[model samples]
Target chain A: MSLQASRNISRFWEWGRKIICVGRNYADHAKELKNAIPKEPVLFLKPPTAYVREGSPILVPLYTTNLHHEVELGVVIGKGGTAIPQSAAMEHVAGYALCLDMTARDIQDECKSKGLPWTMAKAFNTSCPISEFIPKERIPDPGKVNLWLKVNDQLRQSGCTSQMIFSVPYLISYISDFITLEEGDLILTGTPKGVSAVQQHDELQAGIEDIVTMRFTVDRQDH
Target chain B: MSLQASRNISRFWEWGRKIICVGRNYADHAKELKNAIPKEPVLFLKPPTAYVREGSPILVPLYTTNLHHEVELGVVIGKGGTAIPQSAAMEHVAGYALCLDMTARDIQDECKSKGLPWTMAKAFNTSCPISEFIPKERIPDPGKVNLWLKVNDQLRQSGCTSQMIFSVPYLISYISDFITLEEGDLILTGTPKGVSAVQQHDELQAGIEDIVTMRFTVDRQDH
Candidate 1:
């Protein structure tokens, strides 16, 4: 039960740790979804078991009919710390990755209505599809990169990191103040305006500026 | 970054993994809190950093004032499995522990009102305090055992496992169908009827039947 490091930059970093995520960081995305613009970063979580590599297919849970793909920039933490200051937050980053915050939108809505926890909605197996790590040096300014996602070759989401209301360093510092950010932990910066449902067999592709690109196929769970 | 096992039965299990918890499993507790009796187990999470052992103080987060104590029975998973059947679920049991799901009740209510995630309220550092492990053999009838918690020697909660709407085996199987249960992972069965706020310096004691008992002191964060 040891948290193992990614053997190389090309390998998927699948260590068993927490995946902390932000919601509605993009104002346009929040408005489109009819959600109030949060003054602070909206936080949520996905278990480590949600990790699925590039070649693997993202399984649509049997209970969800409206599964959506959210393209986000993922910051991988290299060092662990508590109460990290924004000034030194970037030093703790190991790299960046293109991640799809695959969500069960219908289940999420139901949970929201009932004021229940979103575990079953956000933490199913294969719920997080991550691309290979891009060293922090490659993306000198994570705050200004372009990210986009396409479903079946049609562009569904397109935005730049500049559109984010909360910067990576601020999110890192804020999250660390409460939950200790550990090595191998990941921070999902949040999705942009375009988010829509995907069907089984849909080919989903996402990229972050020309540095990293990944593709995943959606499949229905037979169970 | 390896998930280490407890050094001995007397030590706290400090694996870096998810602490999956059930909410509103006790009918009386749910009624008392004015929450709907969930048709299914309400699930939430706490990060590995939340684990604090006896003798150490549970740090009340700076953001919370009405911090409540929820004493629960924790089931520690021994074997890892997915889509496991209920009949075979017991084989996965490594042991049990007495746990307090320390919660920020005020923050939790606000989060619930806004339909936001409970990470800041539930996953903060020292939000969970657990006693040493209790071997499964020591408590043959997990369903019939009694658990109680006292603050400053004043009994605040007293109930039996029979009050749980969802049994341990069913919860393990149900959760595994969605989130994979790994060795060293823990499932916190929901708390019983009585729950109240605690302030700094409050001495908390909780136990499961006569098998295991633990004491903890609450302290306010210096920050």
Candidate 2:
């Protein structure tokens, strides 16, 4: 799709900043990707352009032929702070939502081979699709939550947040140690295993336990 | 260093929202990084938290035993717009500066192993050190500007923007295609060869041909 489709949704939450993501937070996903579970949290970024509403169509760019879908849980920042203690991180969270961290596996692979950056592969248009906000208080303990995603009603990924290698508090603490978290920011917890490529017209649905669900479709664009 | 050391540079002009970096933008760096020169631009992000102003103390984090410096010319966005044409790209530029894209090579390597996101390796605190602003009009042709960095009086990285894989306008056009450029956002046009590690207390000096020069020191703290 053309750049016109890339708009920042952060304004809705008063978040005028970046979306930080945690990678391989789940044990199964790490093993499936053939990566070792880290002792600490792993962090990454998804530019504002990547944010797409849950109902929007995910455009498949013509440049790369292999595009994949990664279903993740998104944490919206309610306040901005630095070096926040793990015990106090929950106070900073505004809400939660189900998100998809789409990737161009081929392009990312090439970049990895050359010791390069992953922005093009991760921060493209419609790369992230998120559900409406679910206030943090509703989730009680995010770590115990169950998340699942299905394509055309066929289950693709099903895992509980309990399987995450790093807990929510740890991620918040670790991230703040590196960068200051700001209002309207989002932290996309890594996806569980079952990430795979999708074709045009594929109907995707993702849900977080009894909390919320999101539905979307893939489309092909001329640009 | 503690979060207290995070200087509040909230002036929209002073705080760059995102630092878009181009990897393998230079042919030699592509070779040194052991990857083929990409047919298209390789993009990545270094968040605003990574930003360190001219003469700001760059604290070497304890987690990264091997931190390296990547000196490159920086492009500051003046006007924020999307789908900007190559011819009109310069109209959106605010200024230029000298910057260091600091990296935690070891952590980045680990991320490369598990196909993880590069945030921990790239978007760390004090990871970006930038010189004072030099308005775009000052440097008639940013593509031809010369950039270099020195540590404690020893020259480390020296290169010219002429060697870039994507010209300034092209980069602006390409980045805007997916990510919308905002006022105060910085685009780090990739680094040159001779990137190496530096120790605590080392002095770093970087500059662009005739525009801006910056001086800073490495800070080592117990925390």
Candidate 3:
């Protein structure tokens, strides 16, 4: 009988990352949103403050009518660099985790119409819910994992990381070319197709097969 | 005799209370950019990740054809709430400081044209540079503060916080209506009239009247 080696537990102090989110890194999701599949990684940010802890409840702002759930794979950086080459990019990665980049779809639409920043829509309280770090060594290849999201009892979105237009190393290298990646920073790889609107009191269960499971509840801000 | 304390000894996180940034907050700036003074805060997110140490250098991205500097007063929140009365808003501030909301104007304009997120343009690496936090006990009145910026001994922007269309308190309360602020979150009050472009190797300086001075130099990426 083999005893599992005692899992080494470590404490991370108020860890926050520069969340670089890739928009439409996956071709099918981009097609569903009617956006062109970009030649380069499409990036955005979910402020460090937008990070919601694994156990914290996801807050749904009252100002928007439709809030959506986007299940993504988050890559956390252990090293820092500027203009990193594609070959040396993976070395900068510290670990991976399951993340949900929540959005206020209605507000995002308003921003689209008025030509405004998506800050209000893409970033708000509890907009990004991330799982605990899984060391990169555990996952041999990040580009072939199975990702899924389910609301309550029904599965909503399911896809493989293999579908991404840009692979993991490519995204890490591409983003570094544009912005520096620092320790504790996170890159939220794009979500799969079947993105849908979520309502208050909805239970969101999102995960990557055999990796991490994030369960969260959406509630209106109790101001 | 009391020895003078170095301002460098002090550290501050973003003040909690949703940060509300006005779009084209200045009338003249609005006119120059062909935008109207927003009746409401041109609300956006500069997540906690966007916050930096007082004297950190602001990095310039390679793709930007023009980089602009916009100097403004940063209001820190001491107290927080939702639906806060404008009459009682000022009581929430913890203190104020000088800040630069650096912009890759050309990239931002391109995003505006494509109806995309401004993250690439506004929320990139080291885009925000702020001064050390001065407690409210020190800054009695936020609106009366003077803000300025210089590029290598040449004054580029000079203005007082008094010119703002939306007062500090109103912005704090108004922003709280949508997003909730937490400790160490900063609200960059809009920049005054003069906002111009900078080039590689240019030295930038920003500060409050006789209170703080932040300086840095821009360099081209060595990719």
Worst 10 residues of 2 chain A by lDDT: A1-10
Model 3 per-residue lDDT tens digits across residues A28-57: 898988888887676777666677776678
Ranking by TM-score: 1, 2, 3
Error of 2 at A188 (Å): 1.4
Best by lDDT: 1
**C-alpha lDDT (0 to 100) for residue A154 of candidate 1:** 99
Clashing pairs in 1: A1-B3, A2-B2, A3-B1
List chain B TM-scores, each candidate: 0.95, 0.90, 0.87
Worst 10 residues of 3 chain B by lDDT: B1-10
- Residue-wise C-alpha lDDT for candidate 3, range B3-26, written one tens digit per residue: 112112134443231333556776
For the record, the alpha-carbon RMSD of candidate 2 to the native fold, in angstroms, is: 5.8
Model 2: per-residue lDDT, tens digit, B23-56?
7789988788676788888777877778877656
TM-score of each: 0.95, 0.86, 0.86
Off by over 4 Å in 2: A1-14, B1-16, B30-36, B81-85, B109-116
DockQ of each: 0.53, 0.35, 0.34
Worst 10 contiguous positions by lDDT, candidate 1 chain A: A1-10
Candidate number achieving the greatest TM-score relative to the actual structure? 1
Residue-by-residue lDDT tens digits, candidate 1, A119-170: 8788898988998888889999999999999999999999999999999999
